[model samples]
Target: MKLTRLITFACLLFWLTPVAGQSLKSGAANNDEIIYHIFQRSFYDSNGDYHGDLNGIRQKLDYMQQLGVTSILLTPLYESAFYHNYFAADFEKIDPKYGTMADYLKLIREIHRRGMKFYMDMETQYVTEDSRWWKKAFGNTQSPYSDYILWDDKENKKPSTIVFNLTGLRGYDGVTRKITTANLNSEASKAYNLKLFSYWIDPNADGKFDDGVDGFRLDHMMDDLDNKGRLPHLFQTFWNPLLAKLRTINPKIKIVAEQANWFSLGNEYLQNAGVDGVFGLRLCFAIRSFDKKLLLANADSTLAMLPPGKQQVVFIENHDVPRFSYGVKGDLTKLKVGAAFNLLMGGIPAIYYGQELGMTGTSANFGATDANEIPDRQAFEWYKSDTGKGMALWYKQTGPWKDQFNDDKPNDGISLEEERNDPNSLWNYYRQMIAIRKANPAFVSGSYKTVNNDQEHVFSFIRKSAGQTILVAINLWDKEAEVVINAGGNAVNIIGDVRPVLKEGKLVVRLPPFGVGAWELK
Candidate 1:
């Protein structure tokens, strides 16, 4: 729990100093964050319920601190019939399975006490049949909440569904529950959302935000709700107004939206919507593909889309996407490469839980059910045997989803306990990369520019902040490569194995297969 300030020497190229315990002031710049995204149900369990809870997260702060993340983002914790807690049954109440409201408050307070921020994931667009609005407004035209739930019929016999006209979704409990979209245009619904958001921003309305979440992750945010063409101009009408009001309560409350379209650069959201950040999905896909041209193009366009005071949450894995290790077939070298790009890229980097340990899982096709995503959201492996006191195997021996769980293996070096002591482990690589990033300003809040290289297999770039410049090169191929960068500078090796050599007017570096290198230019 000892905290020390990092001192960087001009002559030294690499410094593996830990900055985890450093106290970050509240309302810090969005670009200053390095987030760790967690799916609580798959994380550690404090009790004997086989399910991860708020208290469980509070117990793992030390683990996250050692991993060098400044913020924590949890998926929805609201009461929901689904296992992922997306389709809320009640927006105001915390899911009983996760814990009580008191537990949530304690968790948030503990996060803030450790100088770490917590972002709550909210999907207020749709609710299940158990929701108060749906129960009261589904069939009663005279109900005061009649306009709260969107209805497709004048007689209120049919309710509006979400994307693909999904009237109901099968929960992990093997029960299909009907879902209906909220009437976003209804002033009553808008006011209710604003009140709900305000409550979470300052739970006790004490003006101080230490007890509440520092921000929110708006799930599946879009101007046109569900792309059904029924709701339009929501950016100008619904989001902007509500977010603007929330800003009045806490000007520093950060809101990051998940653009509905994965292919989008989220420019429209940044321009029109009152959001501080959005997921850099295009760059993430590009990095996963390991295509230099695609990576360069996406990186450039993604960064260019951000206006001042806004940021892109650059990440390779999330609760919705397949684990990055699965895409690479658990290749250690490739996983390390991913870690480098995730932390060193010029954006607000986010590390998904278990990503540092190279956990592998892919989305499975289980027709018309949310269970298909359970593979990607399996329990966190705490021990080498994948069984421990705090292990949260909530879905174990459940069904097809459990059969497809490909994340944990005995002695597979994919658990924190296995990787913590190994110097060359994916976990250590992530820790070192994060330390290097935190110690260097260029990697944290720098301007990114692609550095031309001679080898097609190597991708090179420079991150410059103030007067400091750092050159980074990665060999994406499966063989060793010696690449010559066009930039002329005397570079000192920093984080990776590649040693830069200056010959004539260019810098040359040799990289092993799937190797990443960074140098501080003199």
Candidate 2:
């Protein structure tokens, strides 16, 4: 009781609230939201057909819960022609490949039952050529839907960015099947989009907010989220108005933008347009650079840039980029170091499914072809026995590309089947770090300050809130490193693997080649 009293006193002295009203009102600092981003088709296949479906994800909720995932972000489920599902054909339908509307509602209920949030990825900015609107407008520009589609010519250009597709309609990897960019300037498009977003949020039209997703990942959103220059004022005009309506329907709904690119960070998006968060692409690239100065500077600048009530989702790998495991060739020590940095950082952290097991896969080129995004979207590798089955390598023997075996993929027994049994697996490393983040409020939502260290390869920082201070030291190298951090207190070695001593009031520790050690000092 006395020890608890002393600890409480220590924490009270260094209050977590940097701003009293902001901290007390929303208590955003206590929001330790961690999302597991999944390309549903590749996660886990429930049936024998090899395509992962809603039931597959439902079966794996236990695995996600065990890993401490508080929410999930799935690739778009709307009916579309391609495997990635970015091009929506029918906004009202859940792709048959995935399952029916009943399956979706069941998944949502199961997710809510387990006390997890669901966030859907929505790309209402464009639609496939066969869309009802596109089909009607393509042949007859005089159709009522004419104003909804963006055409290169009023009557005859055929809408081509890929020879015959317009810029917004043609996907980078050549996947958009004659995409018809929605005209945000048109009231018709705005009404259609609002109804679509609203339908998913409250499908039954009953007052209960339980049936719809808790949040949304607005894909490829730009001020010109639809297409640049076509409608410059769309965001300030259409999006702000639409989002305002959404808030009225479900006030707690979170809206995060996958902004156009890495340099998109700034206060303008959140302040002017009112997006809840944007991808921290700049920080993500820096962390992947494997450089200490840039990594530290970028992280500091980013956290400092955000105004309260806004967030930047931090991640090392995602569906769009090459796997982090591939960057380091699946080295266990390096993977753990990166894991420590990612989970401990204050911004909302996300894990691309299989990132923990050192999964390696990517479709690096942006050329027009089949499953141009397939390599990285490979199966979750539940078992080591079958390579093609259950994996979402849908492009195998389909056409322009063949089966790509990622040489960097972890060796046999690294699959979930094996890692679940092994105590010291990379998966276990992620599990531990997430558990630590959940246990320590400072690690997930506290204020961040860099801990200066003379060692060139060592990067250290202090994450503090209330009175709890967490010192995270990372060695971004392949050799053993001895570093000293300038923090003093009654310290508890957060991770048991390495013990740091307090000599003359400073913490001293040694990090193995690419090792990480976190400490709790209060």
Candidate 3:
């Protein structure tokens, strides 16, 4: 039974209903968006093929919208030999394991029809041996595609390695495959990537972005590719020019870059590379540390680095990093605290899929293979028993790789089925926090300022805009504490468990262990 477009639309209509009296209002600006980042391969399985596909995502639209995210960001969907889809074999073709091109178009259309944005991840700096460039050019000096890939020898037999000078990577299927760096210096390669990016932005070429992705997540974006100095000044030579042409196609297209140097604030990328956003990697580490001073310093520095119209994509976890729940050791209160900071800290919040459900995973030291990331990118647990329809456990029976898998615990209150119905669950806490963020404009597009507090254990900040002011405070300690913030006025508790009162020209609130509070100053 093929899932027809009509049937899919019917399902969309059914799930699009507002859940639990919460509905996302349409026509919100991009700056006000909450992005839900998904590693689609482990999200949901719709065809019972054990692999998550475009159709699987279509079936879960209601779940995403109900969670209050305004946009969706997916990892690369191009055909690749690797499970994570970074080493592209073909830039133009959709991975056959995921679905057909029709499935992708339908998914994009439905996503736009619901007033949500979609972002595609692209890593065109490298390619696998299976790519057409490598096949036609390797060892063929006379081949026209010779310049398309960087070669270490005149015969073109030895292709340049990516990142750590590694020529090969082990895929999730336990097969080791060789990879080569794409020659970004070649004019042909740059032109090809420009065309590839333009194709996804408007597949039909009619200038209507209804069936195309709203933007792209430039993976591992760096001026000096791999930091080897081989591809220096790529921002001027490759990216800036390519991106300039893309905006001509869609003026509103957004591009976010994953800066290679995580320690740097990425101000250069925003100021020069023409990117709209960059991951706040420093801020993420601070939030995970549960230290008030670290969080305050990083948060201030991160926001200060952004250009006028650019944004800092704040998050606690992504496909490459360990889960926040794992870092907090599965403490529910700490998970809620993480959620509050992720939503109310006055930046573009991106919630990794399953983060709200308290999913736990950590990167393993599995030699030089890409399988080390498998644990962090496990299947999304939909059922409490870890067995049911739409469970995309593709790596379940795959030998040693599955041995490293520690996520998706069955009947452990970590699955969506277990958390969705419990009001006190981390999932519900995320939902409520998102609702609060959407209701307050200050938390969305306002200026972030650190609020001085008497206690060192409480991290306090204020998000201010015209006619709106929101003060957010989080208790970083494991014991209940009372803190006095340096702001006092008529205010009301808008979110969290505690109410703050004014005394001695200060706002005083009692916070429980790992507690959070948001108050709207009048």
Root-mean-square deviation of every model: 8.8, 9.0, 9.3
Please, what are the lDDT tens digits per residue for candidate 1 over residues 176-247? 899888999999889999999999999999999999888999988989997898888899889999999999
Candidate 1 residue spans exceeding 4 A from truth? 1-30, 397-406
Which residue pairs in candidate 2 collide? 11-467, 16-466, 160-164, 160-165, 160-166, 161-165, 161-166, 222-225
- Per-residue lDDT tens digits for candidate 2, residues 27-117, read 1355778999998987877666667889889888999999899999999998977777776798888888788899899999889888899
Q: After superposition, how far is residue 365 of candidate 2 from its true place, in Å?
A: 4.6
Q: Give the candidate number with the greatest lDDT.
A: 3
Which ranges of candidate 3 are over 4 A from the true structure?
A: 1-30
Ranking of all predicted structures according to lDDT, beginning with the best and ending with the worst: 3, 1, 2
Residue 303, candidate 3: C-alpha displacement in angstroms: 1.8
Query: Please, what is the whole-model Cα lDDT of each candidate in the order they appear?
Result: 0.83, 0.74, 0.84
Global lDDT of model 1: 0.83
> What TM-score, to 2 decimals, does candidate 2 have?
0.89
TM-score of 3: 0.93
Off by over 4 Å in 2: 1-28, 156-176, 225-227, 364-366, 387-393, 406-411
